[model samples]
Target: MLLKKNEIVEIEITGMTAEGSGVGRVEGIAVFVPGAAAGDRLKVRILKTAKTYAFGKIEEILEPSPERIESDCPCSEQCGGCAFRHITYAEELRAKENRVRDAIERIGGLQNPDIHPIVGAEHADGYRNKAQIPIGQDKQGNLIAGFYANHSHRIVQCDCCALQPKPFEQALDAFLEWARKSGESAYDETTHKGKLRHLYLRMAEGTGEVMVCMVVNGNGLKGEDSLAALLRERVDGLKSVLINSNREDTNVVLGRRFRTVWGQDFLTDRMCGLQFRISPLSFYQVNHAQAQRLYALAGEYAGLTGKETVLDLYCGTGTIGLSMAGRAGRVIGVEAVAQAVENARENAALNNIENAEFLCMDAAEAAQLLVQRGEHPDVVVLDPPRKGCAPELIRTVADMAPSRIVYVSCDPATLARDLKLFRELGYAAGLITPVDLFPRTKHVETVVCLSRKNPDDRIEIDLDLDELDITSAESKATYEEIKDYILKNYNLKVSSLYISQVKRKLGLEVGTNYNLPKSENTQVPQCPPEKETAITEALKHFSMVPFK
Candidate 1:
């Protein structure tokens, strides 16, 4: 039967996409409906239809799914952030676990994968550590700062969101009232004319330290100083107030240049007793409470001993490395971002940790060099970006043959791909744990433990607690000793030039087509002379020689 726009059709959703869209077969053809989840048999109105599939919206839910529940936030349906808000927490976990399992089996081509129960958060709601609200004016010209609407750049004035802590919501409300009185025009993406572009607020949930950055479209921040001063007085936890001017239309980044007007440039957050200082640009996990659970699982997967040397690749701000520092002999982390490396170093110092050290370098290059130097880590913990481990990095790691490997990933397809590479390198999968850090979203974080195969060793773990001594500090000491031994044998400090060279040769290139800076068409270069030089200097670590 042909479906018409806004015509309610009851269909059973069979599958779900990574973007949280539901899939249903309509006359042997697939139809996609947003705000729908698997196990949902509902009446959805067809919004638009293509030759292959149809787009829809839920007009009336004739029969609610067993997993379905009322969304906590009023704006949950409209906002793009939370996708699984309507589902119960238990069901959400199951869905996330299934997603991971499916990705491994279907995308990774693994048979009967051993996926463990998902690690859950202590608190399901109000666990967010960071929130970025785009500043824009309402229909009545009232200044507002909130998230964009679903599938649109238009700002949605969300005064109440369940994910953000009470302090964050209060601060935003205060800003909204102040901005309305102050007559600051919200940045209009459509017109490219407005004073305020984004209000970036990040809080260290454990410490109650808050960092706020007001992203504007222009260089000069007129009437921002007074606001900053007021914020310092009103906001108890306000540590940093910055202005980031991003004039570009594209949403690649907020801005590069930042001026700190109040307090410090960054804020500190603690996870598993490890302190991590985060800046405006630094990427940290959003859910603080849930992230702790995820990291704990990763540490368990690593099976760290005090005598073991551990290598943490793609160690953003060294959260995992620093957290596991006490349990390991030495924790050496490699990150591509220099700023993140600096932050990681600062975090280590702040925590008074001497055993952990971080370096700014490409993972592939560092691995190859470590292998060449005959100083390989006993255990390797990798938490890579959504892209997962590069093939070169995988090959290098395989050759090194770490005794134990803990792989944490946000994208399952990539995880499976990398797992396949590891399996080929004579590693056997030990355990796979999926953690739902981001609820109401299709995304899931998974930690997989893989050990170098020993033909004679098939040791069985005793599940009984009384059999093992949990009170003893022997495990911690053993992990630390191994780490120290590895670091002493292998020099940690190496030049970034090699890593930079390899990345530039193989990694994807960004240009004008991707809304990047184009200089040839202009009289002067697109970037300011000083800024260009600094960027060039930074890229040197990645082997990207600056364009002369």
Candidate 2:
């Protein structure tokens, strides 16, 4: 059946995507329904339809799933921040754990990946330590401030957000009050005019300190002292208030110049028993409690002794490295951002840590330079961004021949891709832990331990296939495994013939006289391009080798 716009149809939700959208099937076409729970029988009206899939809006919940919950946020429907607000917390954890597992097995090509249980947050609500609320104006030209709608710049007026602390609410209210009183013009993204663009807020969970930075179009805001007083009155433990001028016509939030109008330029915060001075450019973990949990797990995986040197890559403000300084003999941190490197050094000095050092350099370049300097680190820790570590960086780290590698990643897909590279470089990732640092959101943090495989761990074997009378190329993965991989990942079913054909095309020895048509006029359905690509990727994932 062809799905049309405004067509009402009943569909049963079978699964969910990583973006927190429930996936259902109508006449075999997958329909993505937002605000839907897994196992829901929903009456959905098709909003838009594509060739293979369609987007639908829930007309009515005919049957709710066990994972479904009553959303407490009034703006949950518009603001896509709290992705899993409609689902139970337990279910959300389940989905995240499954997501990591799927990434490792399907994407990382690791069979039977040892993934531990997700570390759930104790307080799901009010967990965000950082908030960037966009400032806007209503259609009537009234001052409005809130989060943007899903995939849109339209500000949805929200009095409060469940993900932010109560203090953030007070600070936002105070800012709005000041904005109205000062007649501050809300910035327009389309026009790129007006003064106030955004209200950036940060908190120190350990020290109970807060920093409020107003992102504006110009260098200054009118009546800065008055705005600071208003925020300080409502927000408890207010430490700093500053203005960040972002005059460019880009969607990027922060600008090039930052000037302190009131208070200190940076805010001091404590994490893992170490104090850190957080500037506007410093890359600090937004989720404070869950971040501690993640760092602890990464430290455990590092398995550092008191006498071994540890290298922390992408060391933002030296949080992880400083936390492990007391355990290791010496901690060396490397970061590309200059300001973050300065913060890292400051954090080390603030904690009276004399054995740790921070270097400002790219992760790949730093590893190469350290090799040239004849410095060997016992353990290497990586906490790369969403794009993950560079391939050359992984190779350089492997060249250093560290005993262990602890990797912390925000994107599972990239992490898995890098893990595959590590396997090729003689390093093997063992147990992986996925932590729900961003609860009620689709994003999850993962930490994996990759150890240098010892010679004793491998059993040397030389096989003579001719002696066994087998005249076929041996594949690392079986046909059934490849078929299952394609089915689960792309939701497409493939036959053994297609897999063999793809392997043969790649110069792999498929076997003598295998998958050959008996007659010249035999009608064999060729594998489509999509299925062939999937099969080829599956072959690569399984470590299949081509005939030399």
Candidate 3:
């Protein structure tokens, strides 16, 4: 049927697009409806009709899919923060995994590739580590702190959000009161005026320390001391307070104007048992618990030995590199962000970790320096940003020829491309694990492990072993049985099992943090019902490989 603009058409959603659009097809033409997802039969009014595609707004969900959930946020459809809030948690994970796989298959030109299931978040809600709220006043003249609307720069007041902790909302309220008492005016986007512009809040996971930055338009603070004191008293977890004055007309970020007025300039947090100090603009994982798991997977893929030295390229605040420092002899983290480097140093000092170091430099430059210094790292872990690593850095890593290369990426297409390049340079792609650090969003984090290629290492053997009575077993049996047990239970090949068993025996526990109890007999905790099936599906697809 030929659909016209403003025509009401009911279509079954088949998939989700990267820009958070729900996709359907009608009469062999692609129809995209906003706020629609797979399995949903929605009644949408066509907004625009193009030659090959049509855009529509969902009038009603004629028949909601089983995978749909009642969104907890009041402004779910309007707020741009959560793109998948209407979809069930399981469906969200599936969509994200599919997005990565599809991107890899389509963009990277990889077919029939073994892709691991995505490791999901244990606590989906209140998992965000940072929250940025724009200071705006509604038409009725009430100050609001939340996010912008879907397609507009105008801020929408979000009272209850599933992503942020309860304290954040309270802190927002407290900040508003403080602003009123201080006579601070909210920034007006239309007129380009006002004193207060934005409130950036970041909380440390393990320490619960908070850093709040107030972006202002002018230098003179009318009630700086009083407002700071009030925030410290009212906000229970606040550790750092900063005022960043942006006097320029352009919308550039506040980088240098930050002045610390309270406890510390940065806050500390732990991921994969490694400590890090996060400054105002430092890049840390928004979801803390999931990050621990994500980092652990990266370390495991790196296959680090106690004697191995690691180069953590694009290591923002040294989160991944610092976490793996206990296992690696020395960790050199290089990031382009200077503030992040300072935070990384503070984090190392706070944790009393001496073997880790951080430097502020471009990743490609750092890699080149390593080459110039005649230093080759045994393991090279690259956790580049969404833009991915530069071609030069990739080439440098290939030339250096590390024993193991761990590539942690937020984008899968880039990761697959890098892995393909590494494969061309005599490195075999080992294990690729997808992690869902952000629930109810299209974003997915991936960890890819690559090992140096050796033509002579071709013997393949299974290491599965049944549970044995360690008390009665001899020394040889204990070792052999334990190795086989890990292989059998974990379903890995001999070499992989051997390395994992050795790490465990040597008390080097690496990988994502599972909140296992301190008690020896405690069982692994269970995920929420909505997320369990997705995790099980992911685990089924998870496997190790040996490339010849």
Candidate 4:
């Protein structure tokens, strides 16, 4: 019973996938239908089919799910944003929590994990402090500004979006009206000849100060003053108007060059009782109110007692670290982006946070550098990108021996992968809380607390030298010996877990089972080839294995 493209089939949606698509089955093969929800009965047309799964489009909803609701925004169906807008907020929260739990248990190989309920947003709509709408022309050659349609670059002409505040809509409308009058054409990705590319807007949630930035293909826009005046008159709380020149033929929205046209080049936003200067390139969270909640949860997980030295990895603009600076003895923030580090340092100074310091380096390299300097943190906070922490970074953090590691992640699958690595390195995953930062969207923010397992509690085996066969020290390398060999020969400081993983892959029994119990243990991935070579070389140098 293989499904064919354009084949209409009846399905009873049973659940939801991580991508916010509804799960249904036809003859035991899973079919994912977008715009569908759990508990819905639908007639779907198979768009694509694979050996094990299929993708479909909802043709008709024979029976709607109880959690399903009518979306208020007309563009929600066409726009790529807000995948879960058709479902109730309660259902969204439940789905997010379940997603986190499933990732931890099913993917991370944790049993009965302590996963808390999702913290729902206070206001689902109008919570976003930033909006970047693409400007283009409709089929009639009329100026338009809106979001891209789902999986396509085609602009869905929208004057407003439900996720953004009303002021953004007004600002967008003003820009559209002005562009139409000025006869400026939208930038085409194919031709790359138009002037206007995008309208980037940011609003200070607390102060109601708005910053409008027009991303143009050139240095300046024609009649910029008139456009600024129209925005100031039409949009309340308008504070700054600027232009970002992105001359390069790329898909990136903001360029490196910026010129203020009307007001300041940056706007100030207050968060966690501290004021922050936000430029167009700053990585501030879109949902400010929910960010406060997320940071508060991270702080709570940090459990600062005014005497702990906290290391904030991936500390964007020093927000998370500065949020806890008042209570921490010292806060060291590390970020890879140079501009973000500059902003973080300035933010620390702006907040008068003398106890906090910012450093520009990759998270793993910074942690290793700190360790080299004999600097140990009581708490290490990780807010890595969506790909999650690198295994080497996780190993470094574990080697730093922080009492607690607070992981803030945007992607559950990656978080689960990192958590598994942490567990292998003697960290026990603890309370994990999911927060609905981006409402009406499939994305969810999660904070996980990992505490180092007590070394004394680990099972230790005593061996008698007389009962064992006589062997030289090089016959079987100790973990330290293997590590030293790798570092000395290859200049690669490999983790003991990596060596153990290589050993297991070579059909060698590990000395001790640091992994989960056999029943709970899933197949952990082997060390990457580069590191595996180092591990194999170490094993050979220690005479643990004969030459291949």
Candidate 5:
């Protein structure tokens, strides 16, 4: 049962990988087939083989899976944009949820991750609010616009993708018409001699405002006016047309320089009951409606109270931080992008959120800066990029001693890795929620709630006592009870700090400010011999410890 190249074999797909590849076993050897649906029995041609696994291509469908569907997009196989287009949405969600579960349990080493069922979007069609289609030309020099092939820079021409809104299709069509007449050559990556490189698009799902930005190699488009006029005529609610100049040869889609050729330079979108201005490079979620649900869940897991200071790292346009500003006493947002930080500050002002402030700095630097400024955040919200937060940043934030950490991640593997690190640093994560913000694609969003472990290794849950039926009372003897027991039984008084220091000496977790001095000038008195003897006797009297 060794899998060889071009060898055809029949197998039944039983599961899917996180990358949306169907997995089937042949004599105990796993074959990974892309564009395959689970429960499908198919004849697969082995393309590549390894020691324990192999790569395959679907040769013939012996029996189609019950979850299979006819793909609406013609280029769904070639384009890497959507992986689940050929499968039913329900089945797709199952795969994504399983992916999260596997990552948290298998990779994260958590026995009970407490994973909730994934929250699927209401509808999958045309949910993307933004798109960046690379610009290319056919052999006949006809301009083409579509996504790049999977794992390659070669363009796969798709006039209308199902994931994008109608405005994108209209704008793309208009660009092709104008560029065909104006003779603007597509950027050749090899020679780097052309002007047009990528067609960037953003739409305000709430306001229905559309923005079209042409990413180019040189200064600007030669016939930008005609292009703008054509876009305005074809695309409804055309709000802006601009150019991003990236003269250097790089893989980055948007450039540093931007110039508006028509209309305004930005588009505004509404999310979580707040207005946000979206620039070309703003880190806004692509799915607008689903984003509201995602943010609401993140906020709920954060468990913010009015007396707590909240820190939001990688606060893209301050969306999550601004949403929780009302519930939190003070909100501080930190981001690396200057433009996004500007938008975040403006968003706060636009929403009249006086309690929130935004800073433009890297997350690790901002965390250290906040620590230096004596800002103690009770809750910290982290929404990092796909690569997840750096280990140093996680340690710095944990050092801030936030009571709760809400981690929203796009990559499950990295999220699991970070959660393991947090556990080692005394934060235990529970109740991870997977969200399908990007339907019909392999991408899934997950939010995990981690709480600092107490002395008994129990999580400190911030909630109403009646709601949770739980209190912050220690399991063992209360500090006041211990003090009274010593004073009454042995006729000696003891301070709570001294008792806490004893607990620390016995390897118990001493909470914040228990036995530590307030400042450098503050002196703490040590427990006298008589007080220590009385405390040890009280410990036995109260059945707290067995002492001779």
Candidate 6:
């Protein structure tokens, strides 16, 4: 074996992974070392090893990269909350830009894609407007409150985090004091017992309004009034204090039941020159300033001309749609969460935005409804969850025939996959801009713009069939034969709809009557790599170009 557990070795960090780990190679084997940056020489201790790669931790730094810097937080390494704390902000932005570019070229199969430089955060520290901290007890049976240590559930005691505002520290101190004085035990995940579960704090960056919420095992707490009074007195700009009851034994933090102990149950914040009511259960970006930048970039990609209609899918609380409402003739926002839809309507009314409307439905269902109503939008914006958009939904959006698609994604791999599908649907991927919303972490947000490909851009080929060596029977492959080959070789069943789509993209002539009727419903599964390759070969066998 080349390596063993607890083995120490010296390696030079050459690159970084998408998960913010420094990568080094020994005998062509990759070693991932956390808390290490590129261009750094360090002594590392191997913790685990596999056939092709190994995992290790930095033991000592013999030399540091020029991008490396001294972290201000003492618990940064132990807390695992911030991955780029030891590196400069410039390096973080560059790494994020490279990550986005690599995903598009390597995963999406795009060659030399146009990826702009990353938009760096104006303030790297104290930029987070929301904080969810776990409450636990130390080995001495004393109360401790902080974030989890790395991947483990052990809480690393922290009085303050650099990512949160100054008011959060004061609120933490008050909560800790109140919990200890009231003799409330912190919830233990292993035994599934105790009262206090977590402390959730949110701040409105533009308005400076603060909200304090407590997650507990029960509905109410003893001395709740005193705790509220203490927080209001200690934390400035306090607007709301609420309690969330999570009686279940699951890892999920917030429960459905919420009780207002003091003030209102929601907080209001302004984004993109509009006011939005934020509830505890509502989905909002943690970084307020960077979100503004992100929305502005989306608006630029939409290229609204004041006479065009825009459709936003998975529009959380209608932030992006509302931001572009002024420029577009009309904006329609669709969200699955009922409460979020209500909040979106309320926000529209609050801002007096007359051109925006929100509906409570899933993206696919809403797209189908719009198509049934014969509504066509000039631009479509998609902001989906980490799993990304479903292939069916992508097809539905393409059916809308929107001239432009602005996709806002948090996961790069999923974005690349979806972009590939969009490419096959006659859209040309352009200008992908990565935004550093979460500076110290591995997470990155990207805004990609895809324009409908012009008919003139299609490739034209002239060939002499008489000089071809292959026979007519060998050169022709039926669609059914192609499907069977894919299934037999890859063990993946593909839908006729998907095959038709691919054939159409490859410039193959599908008969006018080849499409299924509207009444025929079927499930089209995602195409895996092996299946995609087989399908491409089938297209090639029939003398068609599989890709541009």
Best by TM-score: 5
Error of 4 at 16 (Å): 0.7
Over the stretch 376-478, how does candidate 6's per-residue lDDT look in tens digits? Answer: 7999999999999999999889866788999999999999999999888767899899999998988999999999765444211212322333333434765
Q: Which stretches of candidate 4 lie over 4 Å from their true place?
A: 456-548
Instruction: Itemize residue pairs with steric clashes in candidate 3.
Output: 117-538, 293-512, 296-511, 296-512, 465-484
Residue by residue across 401-508, what tens digits does model 4's lDDT show? 778999999999999999998988878888899988899988999999999765432211222222333235324667777777777776665565577678777666
Cα deviation of 243 in candidate 6 (Å)? 0.8
The lDDT per prediction is: 0.74, 0.86, 0.74, 0.85, 0.86, 0.85
Error of 5 at 542 (Å): 37
> Candidate 4 versus the native: TM-score?
0.83
The worst-scoring run of ten residues by lDDT in candidate 4 lies at 457-466
Tens digits of per-residue lDDT for model 2, 181-230: 89779888888889999999998888888889999999898899898888
- Candidate 3, residues 460-485, lDDT tens digits: the string is 22232223222221222333543355
Worst 10 residues of 2 by lDDT: 458-467
Report the candidate with higher TM-score, 2 versus 4. 4
Give candidates' CA RMSD values in order. 15.4, 14.0, 15.7, 7.9, 9.8, 11.2
After TM-score superposition, the amount by which residue 373's alpha carbon in candidate 1 deviates from its true location, in angstroms, is: 3.5
Estimate the TM-score of every prediction. Answer: 0.79, 0.82, 0.79, 0.83, 0.85, 0.83
Better structure of 3 and 5 per TM-score: 5
lDDT at position 267, candidate 4: 73
> lDDT, candidate 2, residue 11?
96
